[model samples]
Target: MNDLETRQLRYFVAVAEELHFGRAAERLGMAQPPLSRAIRDLERQLGVVLLRRTTREVTLTPAGEVLLRDARTALDAISAAGRRARHAGEPTPRLRLALKPDIDGGLLPRILDAYAGQEAALPVDLVLGRFGEQAQAVRDGRADAALLLAPFDDHGLDSEPLVTEPFLIALAATDPLAARPSLRLADLAGLSLPDGSSADQGPASGWHDRAGAHDDAATASIAQDASDLPEIFRRVELGSVVCFFPASLTRRYPRPELAYRPVDDLAPATLAVAWPQTSRSTAVAAFVLAATTVAAATQPQKRETPQTAVT
Candidate 1:
């Protein structure tokens, strides 16, 4: 309704997410009675039953489910608007870009240099995040653009592909498979892989998407969880788990104990520049153009299919 306030939506979202009035109240830094009254009043004004409650528990009605989804989008948009307004008011507003370290396919420096020469370029602000965080940062207006890998969630964003490189399987050098010239995806069917869903893992870990082996039951059963690249390398060296990584990683993080071999049938990883679909900033446009141009000049036009090379 036009009469609905952002505060009411915020209150509703907290309760809907927590599913407990007391917990939501505590989260919102308020007491239970007033929170309960506010929800009741909101339902009356909307002429809809949003929640179903009992002494034992709380649940969302069908309408409430729909509201919860839409409410989050609305709240994010409101927050973005406020952020943008404040940023615009600054005397020298910088263009915020989000990315994960070592995931840009080694094109970041060139891209930055290229953008610096653009007429509309502004000072770039780098916002580094872990895996699965760049897209949301763009969506919520925290960053103007991002450099991300492919096979990521691209909803509510527009992106341009920069470079695509084949995948390599990282395993203990002592493992039998490491001696092979090249391995097929089927060779890893029964091996344990890293769980990308681990909170500590970032996209740069090389196994964030699990690529071609995601559907394999054995691969799905996580062998170990790691927080950073060195930890992942340690697990691989110890034969705790095998991982799929973009070919670029071999050059960046070559290790003596770990061997990298190409997977013949595995899918390749693409690096792209992404920004909010609704973005109109000239700085964002210039940055995207600069990134794509630098990629075209510096990256190979066609990557050779995986062969027996091991690093």
Candidate 2:
């Protein structure tokens, strides 16, 4: 019998994880036919039928199941071995980092500075994504680590809050709700972010959404603005949605009628730096170090908050 190769193991794992050939191919950044042939090659080399393929789905056979577990262990070891070799050759530690737009404030500038001080060779590749997607990226091995806002609790993640941002509501200049100062979530209810369209139009898309947006036209959607966004702002920026965001973003990007008001009831978004608990990559650690340094900065500022005696 021929010894199993790492490429076959990788292909098998990808198929197992996706459970769909088309999706697995997309995830692997390849096309479908080649992937199918590769899977066939892997099965032939192993001398066992690993997958049961049907018109719509794929299932692992018993032999495939056993190989899947062993494959993951071997792949992990191979990846670790390579990382170790790279680390030994150079003291520099750099990794791919993910940042979702929702996690605003002090961290961005600090992350940039932290990675820049690296050994002139170690480099950090920062990937941008939505707030909801960052944790998945880290879990899937697509990113070494991420800066995120919490309420995200995953079995694989190890997270520590770096900052807590206050939520603020945003409204269009012409909206009636914008007339009110310092509105709450209740006040913003029933209001929708206009898709940069005239307000006289009724029952737009996402009308059922109490907190989203409305647009008469589907193809002509507007991109929500947030050159500076807080945690709440992140949600709004994603759609024709009137959502709240962290207060710091309001101060950074001032608008006369893009009114911002404090929402008293909702929990303030907690900005956290997170990684898969199982990851021990130097790249992951260095990414954490850069993000955590932002936390350390947050700490000193917290200590500096003036103490007021409760009489």
Candidate 3:
């Protein structure tokens, strides 16, 4: 209808594109019932049937086919107009990004400093949160981008590796093994690890055996398991089990009460920069470039020998 707005046409086009009312409703941020009503209203206003729907499938009718092309053209033109207007925005828009708790140390700090020095007009803001929630925020457009440990595979998203960091060991300053500059995994034969989270969810091949109780300090641990969250941190708190973590993370969010050292043979952890493929903001690209540069400059982990011991 001539009286109908471009917004309704846009809504109709989205439903037409997806051909699924539920998905369209979700995208529209409305309930299915209201979406169905809106579509019916649109059809009534146009005085033409635009969709062919049934319980098994939904398809565009001949009328919908005609409307689809026209709607897309109109929407694209409007979007282009908006982008042109947005081009006048500040060249460096402050970028809001999400990050893993493990990155509070070296990697993020270096990136922020690099961005500040290179793009003085744009400042970088890194927000720390759970990985799953952060990834979702990027997809939903709540965040400009995010930094996450890898294994993320999601549609409509893009990711790039930023760093590959190795694991480190942490203990009280009084622990006997702390005196070594760096120790082989085999050297921890009868020693215990204290951090629970890294011990379980992380690789434990050389440090733990995975056969002991959560609180069994005398049994000794050789593997880190993520499956049991509670038990892992508990033992670490009591100073009975030594915990392992990505070296970068440990440096960022350091435990003043604990001393950390590197495990020579453990594999490094990968950190990735992720953003929605739909983003066209120039700031996002600038941030990514700066971040990748820091990744490139990142030093390969060195073998650590401890200088203290658990008291």
Query: Each model's number of backbone clashes?
Result: 1, 5, 39
Look at candidate 2 and give me any clashing residue pairs. 213-240, 231-246, 232-244, 232-245, 233-245
Q: Tens-digit lDDT track for model 2 on 189-277? A: 45554333222222122221111122222412332232224433444444345744567656777765466666666557677788878
lDDT of model 2, residue 297? 69
lDDT of 1 at 106: 86
For all predicted structures, in order, the TM-scores are 0.76, 0.54, 0.47
lDDT of all predictions: 0.81, 0.63, 0.65
TM-score of 3: 0.47
Q: For model 1, how does the per-residue alpha-carbon lDDT over 1-311 read when each residue is reduced to its tens digit?
A: 55889999999999998898987898799999999999999999989999999999999999999999888888888888888888888899999998877788988899999999999999999988655678777877888899988867786789999999987888899999999988886677567656633222323434564432333345444422332667778888998778777788788998889899887766678889999888899999999999999999976569779899789
Q: Which ten residues in a row have the lowest lDDT in candidate 1?
A: 196-205
| Alpha-carbon runs more than 4 Å astray in model 3 | 1-93, 101-105, 117-123, 171-235, 240-242, 252-265, 299-311
Model 2 CA deviation exceeding 4 Å by range: 1-94, 118-121, 192-240, 300-311
Candidate 2 C-alpha error for residue 230, in Å: 14
TM-score of candidate 1 against the unseen true structure: 0.76
How does model 2 score by TM-score? Answer: 0.54
Per residue, candidate 3 scores C-alpha lDDT tens digits across 1-311 of 36768779878987998788887888788889988999999999889899988999999999999899778656655664464346436575567787655543367777777777764326656665533456655654446788866555445578888777777776655677778877567766666444233332344432322322233344234233422434544445456776666776566655555667776766666778888676777777877888898888765767789888779
Task: Sort every candidate by lDDT, greatest first.
Answer: 1, 3, 2
